[model samples]
Target: MTLALAGGALAQDAQKGGTLRIVGTADLDHFDPTSGALVTTNNFLRATQRTLISYHASTDEEERIRPVGDLATEVPQPTNGGLTYTFHLREGAMWNTPGGARQITSTDFERGVKRMCNPALGSAMLTYFVSLIDGMDTFCDGFAEVEPTVEAMKAYIEENDISGITQPDDLTVDITLSETAGDFIYMVSLPTSAPAPIEVLDYMPDGPEYRENFIASGPYTPVDYVPDASLTLARNPAWSAEADPLRAANVDNIEITFGIQPDAAIQQLQAGDADMVYDITIPPAILSLLTATADDKVMTMSAGRTAFLFINTVSDNNGGALKDLRVRQALNYAIDKTALVQQMGGPAMAQPQSGIFGAGVLGYHDFDLYPSEGDAGDPEKARALLAEAGYPDGITLKMPYRNQNNQPEIAQTIQAAMAEAGITLELTPVTASDYYSKFMTNPRNTEEGAWDIAPVGWAPDWVGGAARSVFQPQFTFDGRHQTYNYTDYNNPEANEVAKQAINATTPEEAARLWAQVDELVMADAPVVPYYSEQVVLYRGPAVENFQPYALGGQGDWTNVWLNR
Candidate 1:
């Protein structure tokens, strides 16, 4: 397969009509990018929507280390020592409507950014992505106590009292940062930068309607959507050939289904019922089948998302299980990640993720001690530690799991390991929707149904420590931090250390500090590391110009085509 950037050259005789059916295990709790805060949902938005500047899927290794550009013609560059960024908007870019009419323009970009940054809009992305843009932080702060209301946010924007953003002209906007940000390009690739004509999200604060009905500036526009079930896309007729040369406007429709299990999705793919499946947890059965059929038709790809066990430290229940660092460490040591991955699939096909940022990311180190000598599946050692803590049996711990491809089997593997280590794990697998809402979003409390451990994953929003913000305290409501720092394993010193790493002056310094943060996390054992997923983008044998990588979906499918 050719490694080409998004919108690169493709076959001239590519089929102009066909349907691509994509099936996956789950759907976003909500379609709104700011509110859903789930990576799975965001993946759809990435392909179906467009960001101002996206990291190029086919840049050099160094350029790929950070985002280059996806929508914007060029990557934003700073004029001063990273204080000011001059972004040149791509000309002729316009929004696409489902009805196949004309497109919209730069104002859409402007309003989108404002909506995302608006605190009253109640977008969690504001806490994550808004911090990157100039004055956005201040604009957000201006609304902090002003009630999270749409009218208030719109009024704030109309008055132009936002601190960091300056739209001096219609096409030219200047962003002044609070401090020097060398990896500004990385910040641009986040969903917050993905423009959403402010008008669409104006009154609607929370719901899937906005995403299902809203117009987009992407290659495809949402033509149909069924709640928690399916979404269909049609070529954006407004897509200009000058701006997006490889736009197929072909493949008559792209249909995406949600809530279908990965194993089911794989079966559908084998039966030719589906064209692609996202959110696939590598299952051993599927891997064997793909390997057996290597000659005929099969391809698998690994994306940059990492799955792990989120141990809620702040939970008032669980009887201080997470409070004991020794217990956390024991849990970390007892589980055989290699066995888990193998049970799920092959090691060659899937890598065990070590840190928050997987292989595709820079400054990532295999900091987690799993896969190391003495740490991998040391059941005796784990038991010894548990006994040392107090040979207390009958500790029925609840473990939550979402129905991914191999999750049930994976959970069994973990349960078996923990049981052998003298810890009783009660497998409580919940529906995908309830699993996300109850276990994931619930505040940490004794009353809130707590889980001893649950699967959690993240896709980097930006390239730097900002990507690590999920682990930060602010992201969690007053109660739970189930994402990363969920274990209530708070260390003021470590917090300061990570802050120093994020705010570090140089890349080298920042890397050193990030290493320190990793060391702290591993030492604390807040999470048990799991496999890094291989991005699997299934296409018919006739399809061409599609590359799969960690950065984004289908690794720039802009030039993809089907043989008629």
Candidate 2:
């Protein structure tokens, strides 16, 4: 399991073995791989967990997202007409067990997949698996009927099996998908697919008890984690460089400090007090200053992310007006996209989006269903639509925004534009960590009409040829809403087209169908898509072998070496 190093800074002789400090604002969503939802979570888990397949930590934009063998000895080609993936696990990929070093095997992956529908904080990326893997839905349905306690969850896991997955031997894993998916390799590369040890079955998924008894399959083992405060990861005795090709494990220890503002974090980086950021993006003002100074430390990378106002079509607010197509279109017409882009640090960092797909995502194409003057928006068009929808005077709507990275300002911008179109907005602010977990992703909130529209953002689950990653999780393909679908909006036409796009034999055919799905989804106006986001990052002077992680939208933490 060896490959040539390919990061932009890997050419330099890396002075290995030092403590690399990481600073950030928000705490990690999950310490466990099966439950990780955020890109930052993926970044953090890379140090402590090993997936079946993984992308290299490279500065090359395209190469960084390409999947290669990690815990698996080699990336396998599909057999049985592309529905079968047989992973050959590497021998030396060991877990830091209390008993001693223990080799991870096929059963660990089986347990990991079974834990997805745990009645406790279950896997947010469960949608990716249940639909693709054969009999997974049945397993999840059966598991859901069990009690939420750790004992019950573990009992059910032990008693049942997912029929799609099988263990031929200790080191061999066989996964049978119901349908052939071309990008299944990339899907396996995600943290959600990482193998879970038997010890984890004793605790609830991602509970404090599980975090305390953290195990490691990668170069580092997480320890001393305090939610929203700090964490420290020390070298894992069980891990060896030969077992995995993706991470260098140059840093002997990794220290993480939380609750630091982005502006202050950037300054700390320049002073060599920190190596990288954990979760927050650099402030636009600070990024501008760094860019103007021609700082090589500054990195501007393309993120397969989109920022938008997610409309609650399920809400009964304004007399269930959001469900009306005319009202939803009015909401889109009333948004000043140029203002939104400027708040996101101008066109250099973001572009006004007109469709569901983000810029650089596989199926993305230029299309404007609601064309506005200079992207400044059309208040007249909105008002006309509002009148047509029976809101003669105006409609009042609630908007909640995450309190991080210029979002409050962006929300204000949304409020001002909506005002011009006879729509009044009531604003609510939420902490970044709780924004999704407590408020938005909870379908009950939308059903209760707690929020009419909310500022939301999304990065694809995987990078290349990932239209399915973007569209599938966030949209309703069947009657059921997946993880990221905030409003639970459904369209039968869009669902059928999405199936076609994902199953298409060629990239050309897939893109064409995905493009059609995008139009069908937008025509319903479930969300007022604003901009495709590009993140600007700054690393500390001591951070060497730095690479732009397209998913994390920051420098690679697991692979980079410390220079100081």
Off by over 4 Å in 2: 1-4, 8-12, 477-481
Q: Give the number of colliding residue pairs in candidate 1.
A: 14
- Weakest ten-residue segment in model 1 by summed lDDT: 473-482
lDDT of 1 at 168: 64
Tell me, by lDDT, which candidate is best.
2
The ten-residue window of minimal lDDT in model 2 covers 1-10
Candidate 1, residues 300-347, lDDT tens digits: the string is: 543455677867666655567666777777777677777666765666
Q: Say what the RMSD of model 2 is.
A: 1.8
> What tens-digit string does per-residue lDDT give for candidate 2 at 1-564?
343467645334776788999998888877888888988887778888998987776678879777788888888999999999999999888999989899999999888888877877777778788889999999998887898988888899999999999999999999999998888888888888888899999987887888888988888988777778999999999998888777788888889998998888888888988878887777778777887899998777776789888888886777899889999999999999999888877789899999999877777899999999989999999999999989989899999988886777889999999999999999999999999878887879989999998988888887788888877778774555566788666778887888887779888998889899899999888899988888777788887778766656677777788776
**C-alpha lDDT of candidate 2 relative to the true structure:** 0.85
